[model samples]
Each structure stands twice: as structure tokens, then as C-alpha cells.
Target: MSVTIDITGLPQERIAFGPSPLAELGAALHALSEPGHHARLHGWTTTTAAGLKPELADRLHEADFMWRSTRSDILLPAQPRETLAEELDDLDRMDDERYVAAALEINCAGFYDRSGPSPLVDAAMRQRALDLAAARGPRQAAFVRRMLADPPGTRAWIRRLLEDCDEAFFADTWRRVHVQLATDARHKTELMRRKGLSGAVAAVSSALTLEEDAHGSRLVVDKLSDGRTTAQGSGVTFLPTAFGWPHLIALYAPGWQPVIQYPVSSGELAGVLPVETVKLRLEAVSHPLRMRLCRNLARASYTTSELADAYGITAPEVSRHLAVLKKAGLLSTRRRGRYVMHQLDVAAVARIGSDFLEAVLR
Candidate 1:
């Protein structure tokens, strides 16, 4: 029997960032916005600022010193809700052209160093400032208002504005925005944090371009820094023995590139399936008693005796099933007090399902 379910009727809400100069400015600032939430993002500002003109570099340094000495109290707070909310409201009320001009001016002033102002910075700043100020309200309200005023074509004005902001201001603004975002989405941030540190570490790793190995069956993972592992054998069927499959998938999805690298030793078998592994996975999946045990353990950890009583099976039968599943990499065991508790290996199960389907199709 086959089951088919169509999901075409689902409603989707698409988030569109419109073309206002100020809005573009805001969007550009997004990378720098959230501060305390992402420590890795700090590199963006420092790295970008290193290449600025000499005068601008001096100004950035001065601004950093000034900010450290004077505004430390305001900037060091755990949260800046009232300030951010006010800024956002102001940005919403501004006109695109005017807001863009104002933002540009702000950026230029922020970025200008002791060498004096450059025409590029001056022209760009004036344009953005006018774009932002054209709209009306408080600072943030005006920013948003201007950003939403026109179509995205005016984004050039905002980009120019960002380029002129001194490194100090750019970094500071980025941190502020990041903190606001983190405050708004505490739950998601916590979940990501618990998943493991691999994602966070990878985000900051040096970029490496991947290429197919000579064998045509594997991708070589290279461009590693320091003493980290650079390459490993990888495939849809190359199941992980630690942390199971879900964690592995999360770590190696398309969006999260440069993960585990494929080796050159594996020969190309483009359409071929690993029949033996598939058979093993299928047999693992078809064991009804094992499935029942997994479902029960998912709710709460259970001992063989407890599981046996719950499922109305003998203690020895439960033990046998647990042992088999454990050996199959579908379950994990830990001893608590005098009893051993069992839990489903969620990652392993997911990998088994994925590998089984892939093998059958191949």
C-alpha cells in the first residue's frame, strides 16, 4: 500500500525587505545589529575596518577611545530595549531619500578620521542623510519611515552611507542591533546553543572552496586552520557513530557548508546503492517490537523491567530487543542507580531512514 499526501494548500508568509533607502540602510546594518547574541559577528566590523583610508582609520581609533571612556556605561548594559524601540519607531516614520541622506551623513561622521573628510564620504553621507531625514519622526522611526519610502533601487544610497561610517560606530551599532535581536528570540538562541558548538565554530572558520576528488565519489574537505581535522569519508550512508544522525545532518546541511569532507579513496558509483547497508537498515526499521520500545523510551527513559511491564512483555524479551537495537545503533543505554535506562538514538534512527530511502531509490 502507498500513502500520498499533498501539502499545496499551505499558507506561506513571505518576508520582504522593501526598497527604501533607509530600509536598505537598516538591512545593511542587520549584520552588525545583534551584539551579545553572537560573539563571532564581531569579526565582521574589525576585519572590514582594517582596510579603511588612513584618516578614516585614525577617526575610527579615536571614536573607539572616546566611546570607551565616555559611553561605556550606556553601551555595557545587558539590554537596551527602550533605546532600540525608540530608534525603530523613529526609523519607521522617515522618508526614503531624506533618511538615506541622513544615515549617510551619520556614517560619514562616524567613519571620518584625522585626515579630514573625503569627497566620496561627503557625497555619499549627504545623499543618505537627505534620504533618511526626508521622512519624519524620532531617530529610529525616521530611519524606518525613509527606508520604506521608496523601492529597492535607492539601496545604493544606503551602501554608500555604511561605507562612510567610522569603524567604531559601525561595530557599536552592529553590537547593539545584535543584542536586540537576541533579546527578541531567546528561545531559538538557546536551542541553537544546546545543539553543539560546531555551528558557531564553523561560522568563523576560513572559507574553503570544495571540489570533487579524482574518484568522483567523494568531496575533499580542505582549507583547515591550526590543528583541526581537515578531511573524512562522507556520504549519505556514512552514518555517524556519535551523537546519532540528526545532529550530523544539522551540522552538514546545504546552508551549513564546509562541514565533514569526503575523501578521495571512495570510487565513483554514481547510481549504485550499498545493498548490504540498506538491507541492515531495512531490517532494523521493520522490527515492530524495537519500534514500540523506541516510542516508549522517547517519552521518558526506561529500564528493561519497566518497559516489559508497560508493554506487557517478559523482562527477558525486553532485554533481548534492547540489546539488538543497541547493537544496531538505534538505541543508547546508561546505568542509573541499580537499573539500566534506555533511550532512542534519534540521530541514528534518522540516518537509517535516510540511508534506507536513498539506497532503495539508487
Candidate 2:
């Protein structure tokens, strides 16, 4: 199954590039909560997760679904503003009907009864939403019910969540990664100019390809879902994000601009420290916590949270240790449900000595 976006008449000037702090913030939340999905972000996720306040942590837990799938415009606005504050204000200033409708659509997990009257006004649609939410879980069902009952209150709660997330971690994170995102955007823009849209698309991800036929040009994204959306008047917006690595988020929600948020290219980050990479791997296992983690992982795979509990350490601390080991190329990961399961790369660890010698000799 795949999603094809028809960009038949998409103008050259319509091809845009920029960084969205609000979008990145949403991606960060998704990465933090679903650590197993973004192995490349192990270091940043752990450090940020450790610093979150208790209240913020609880709120994030409850609202995990909103950010996880990137399905809703409320979380990731189709058109990003220059700053997060501006983006939040845009959301705040949105008309009540539009705001509530979007929230309701997301709360129901994309279950919309379009066959009925206008959204939020149709009784059948509300019932449909409630029915779908019920199947997901109790928490999700409750949230949908509350959204139907009091939309303004729910909107306020969502606003507070975004603010809290920013103050807790995203604000600082933006400052650190925004420059890199901008650099990536420039690189992509050049690629599009030099090699055309297909080249830029390929640079973003292998899962994305451009196809042309009698129907016109379409950007086909390799996704689990099957659907097609024609480019609306707003054209396509390409967003680069630092925290959204190892996965691409393509938003094709109706009544909104089509968006593709991809991980910033890391090719430019190739450092001159080939030997240092090997040293990092060796030094990573030398740490007492990491050594134990390596040994335990050698026996069985474990999530960051599970390892933290077993070692009587904070999750952030375990994450920090795990990040080092992963960077050293001594760790590997896979996803099991919502959690990232970690395992030791025994062969990589064994090759460290030989790798060091080869690098030094060369």
C-alpha cells in the first residue's frame, strides 16, 4: 500500500523549503515517546526525556497519540510560522468551528463521517467518532468524549500542553538544531534546482519516488496506508526537521495544505575523526553502567525504561549511557510495539581493536 500525491500542475515557485519549530516540536514528542521508532535520536531523546518535569511527563503520556502519527494539523500546522509563538497564535486565532472540527477529527483517530452534515454538527459523525475511539483504548475514548462535550476546554488544554512542552525542552532544542535545519533546507532547495524535484525527493528518503503517467505527475510515498490526494492551491510544503530522523511524516489530511516533513540530511556531518569513532565504541563499553547494559543486552533485548528499572537508575541516565554505546557502534535496536528494544552488537565490539589498528596503520 502507498499514498500518491498528484503534483501535476505544481509550479516551480511552489516548491518551498523551510524549518518549522512547531512541527519539529511535534516530531520531538513523537520521538521521545516512541523511542524505538527513531534509533538515530537516542542521544537527544534520553537527555531531553530526563529533564522533563513530572507534570509535563504525565501530560505527554496522556496526549501521546496526537503527536505519534502526525495526522492532525492542530499538532503540526500545514503552513509553519517563523517562530513557535507565532504558530501557537495562529492556532489560537483560528475560528472556533475550524479549531474544534480539526480537534474532533484527530481525537477520533481520523474517523470522520463525511456522509453526514457538517462536522461537529452531525450526530452520526459524533457517534462514529466515539465508536472508533472506544476501540483504540479507554484513554483515547475518554479524550474523544471530552472533545465532543467541551471543545473550548479541550483546546485550552492542548494549548497548555504545547506551551509546557516548549518550556520543558523544545525551546532550547530549537535553538540548538534550527541552524542545521536551515542548512538542510538550503541544500535541498539547491538539489531541486539542479536535479529537479525527483532528485530532492530521493535525497529526502528512499521511500519517496516521483512517477509520471497520463494522469499527471505524482509523488508516491511508500506508506502502510493506501490513498491519493491532489495538490491543493497551496502547493506542497517541504519541512526539514532535526528530531524527525529515521522516519518521514507525510500529511495528506483534507482541507489542509499537503506537507512532507523529512529528517535533515546528515551527510554534511561526516567528521574527520574516523579513529575517534572506534575509540568512542571502545570507551562506551568501558563505563560501568554501559558494560552491564552491554552484557545484559547480549543475553536479551530490553527497552530503555526497562533497563532503567532493572538498574535502579533514572530513564534519562540509562538513555544517556545507551546513546554513547549506540554512537560507538556497539549497540543495535528494534521496535517492539511502542518501545525500542536495545541489543549489543557483539561483532562490532569485537572488531573495535582491529578497526583501531587498521585506522592507525592507514
Best by TM-score: 2
Candidate 2 local distance difference test against the native: 0.69
Q: How well is each residue in 244-300 modelled by candidate 2, as lDDT tens digits?
A: 654566767666667788777432112244787757776886765666666445433
TM-score of 2: 0.68
Provide backbone clash counts, one per model.
63, 0
* Number of colliding residue pairs in model 1: 63
Evaluated at residue 210, the lDDT of candidate 1 is 21
